[model samples]
Target: MLRRRRKFLEEGYNCALCQDGVEETIEHLFFSCSTSSCRWLVLGIFWNDGGNIFDKLSTAKQAFPFPFFMEVVMIGPWCIWKERNALTFNGKAPNLATWKNDFKKEVRGHLCRIKSSLHDSINFWLDAL
Candidate 1:
């Protein structure tokens, strides 16, 4: 069984997203947490066995001709962090439906902001979704 940490809070620290009885550390938040793991699996569906998301993002400018990869890298962590904060501060629960809807909106917004024509990029994003 996972031992709960009681370092900072008056009560024990529980993961706001997964509630899997692990302390909320950076490692847990981004990779080990069940919630994050699920998100990563779903993201993998889009990325298609691209190793790590951060690895791909770091090479975006060199490997990818378009800015879509950068947008995905930027948005994925931001959305996860946002969800964590919402759960921590607002007592909100994890809702994949809302998360996915927001992701689509953010992706659409990012695609629209690209200055060049994105015919193929748009199709790629649509297919990925």
Candidate 2:
């Protein structure tokens, strides 16, 4: 993204993803991209069916309420990206099942710090389950 950002600026474009055609900005790609993964982030294609990106990001950045439901969501895409790289570079096929399991493991491994920052603690467990 850094390279793309630099290149985009050098090319006088506002966005690498949209080529300055729309409201192209990093925030848009991060929280508003229409790509499947980004849409998943905003629309909860699998993890966040109850709200949009604004609500989700606010919840993820929360320092109160003791609900870590957002942590799982936050950590999920890293695992997905790793799987994406493995498939892209290793010539292996995608495996949603294994990817999900690994995502859970990864989330659990780093989720302790975020455990206290949730809207409802129970919601975290529900999401993990």
Candidate 3:
């Protein structure tokens, strides 16, 4: 449901987040866009322009513990999508602080659902951030 695909179906679709008039593909929105790139960089994840998000995740998975990586994979893009929606629908500008705060909030919330054994590891990772 990226703007690139939607553009094919309709017309005048552009990336809501960047507003750079680029066709918003899943890869572009979540991986390659400047906004997303900054987010990833802050997380210490540097994505190459070689492939899609999943491909990048596959490469990254080799570097990090799986559970922590999965948390990143889930929460990061969810924040990006929420930012996209905020801009697309509410005219709110993207805020990195807000994104970070939201990510922390989500990580904290997720802690309640996971096993207690992982709390220290997850909290350690979160603290490192």
Best by lDDT: 3
Which stretches of model 3 miss by more than 4 angstroms?
1-11, 65-67
lDDT of 1 by residue, 1-129 (tens): 112222224445666688777888766777667787676555552332355656544544365444455566567667788887776666667787677667667666676666457646655764675
**Candidate 3: minimum summed lDDT over ten consecutive residues — where?**
3-12
Q: Name the lDDT value of residue 82 in candidate 1.
A: 88
- For candidate 3, lDDT tens digit of each residue in 13-111? 667777687889888898888888888877776666687667787887776654667777778899899988776656577888888777778888888
Q: What is the C-alpha RMSD of each candidate to the true structure, in Å?
A: 6.3, 8.2, 4.9
TM-score of each: 0.62, 0.44, 0.79
What's the CA error at residue 43 for candidate 2, in Å?
11
TM-score between model 2 and native = 0.44
State each model's CA lDDT, in order.
0.62, 0.49, 0.76
